[model samples]
Target: MAKEYEFTQIIKDHEGVIFKITTIYTNNHEDQKDLYQEIVYQLWKSFDNFRGDSKISTWMYRVGLNTAITRLKKEKRKGNQIGIDQVIMKQTDQYDTEFEERLKILYAHIHGLNELEKGLMLLLLEGKKYEEIASITGLSPSNVGTRISRIKQKLKTQIVKK
Candidate 1:
């Protein structure tokens, strides 16, 4: 359908969201790449049901995050050891190698967070509305607001230390 084509185009234009979500959920490079592919595949599968009820990006966050969560669950069950270099980092322009290393350290800390905190921060960084984050993450609006506030303070402290 034309809608599906447009949706694919939109995803291609804004690929960073997928990358960010993958980075947020995965501990290592291989898992990141797998999660990124799973997000893309889920998005494509869900395209026909989009219905334009929400912003495409909001819908995408929902699908991608859900897919990542499910994949994490599956990995836990299978005892999989996702390799670091399995990720194809061949296209990281502008972000230098040092920045990537620092980002990996940051991501490692982020991966230590509980699932709710991780989801909250990921959507917050993606600029989703509080209501939208609640819709996707199943938190009350006020709870989402409080959590985001705390997360910001925590991130500030961490950044100050570094």
Candidate 2:
């Protein structure tokens, strides 16, 4: 019972992280919800083995990302699905039209990146420090930095060409 409570609280505290990951990895609402549930399920399955060696958020990212990547691979093996034409933007009135358009463009470019680059860019966009990203991704901090630099330049070039 106590274990369930603890796990529930952890999920509540970090639900946004899960949502962001799901949104980044999935193209539509149904897929996003499926991925979100899968991530939570995987997290719960491994809850007993969590040793507190890392921040819970880091652990969650590691598990969530690995699960998402694995699912994507499985999906590819099952053959291609039709791509959705509409981008999934959060429905918020706070942003002006121009900012929203730019955000859409940004996400489109992000979706074009390779899987590893997509994960790295997602972590960077979440404002995680290099060391945290490195820990979550199993990459050296310097490699994270180098990859991010390349990703930024790639995004810049792509956006410019658009």
Best by lDDT: 2
**TM-score (C-alpha) between model 2 and the true structure:** 0.84
Global CA lDDT computed for model 2: 0.84
Q: Per-residue lDDT for 138 in model 2?
A: 89
Each prediction's TM-score against the native?
0.74, 0.84
What tens digits encode model 2's per-residue C-alpha lDDT throughout 1-162?
Answer: 999999999998998888888877878766776677779899999999998988999899999999889984334333333332132335555588888888777779889899899999999999999999999898999999999999989988997887
Model 1: colliding residue pairs: none
Native-structure RMSD, model 2: 5.2
Provide the lDDT at 31 for model 1: 68
Q: Specify the highest-TM-score model's number.
A: 2
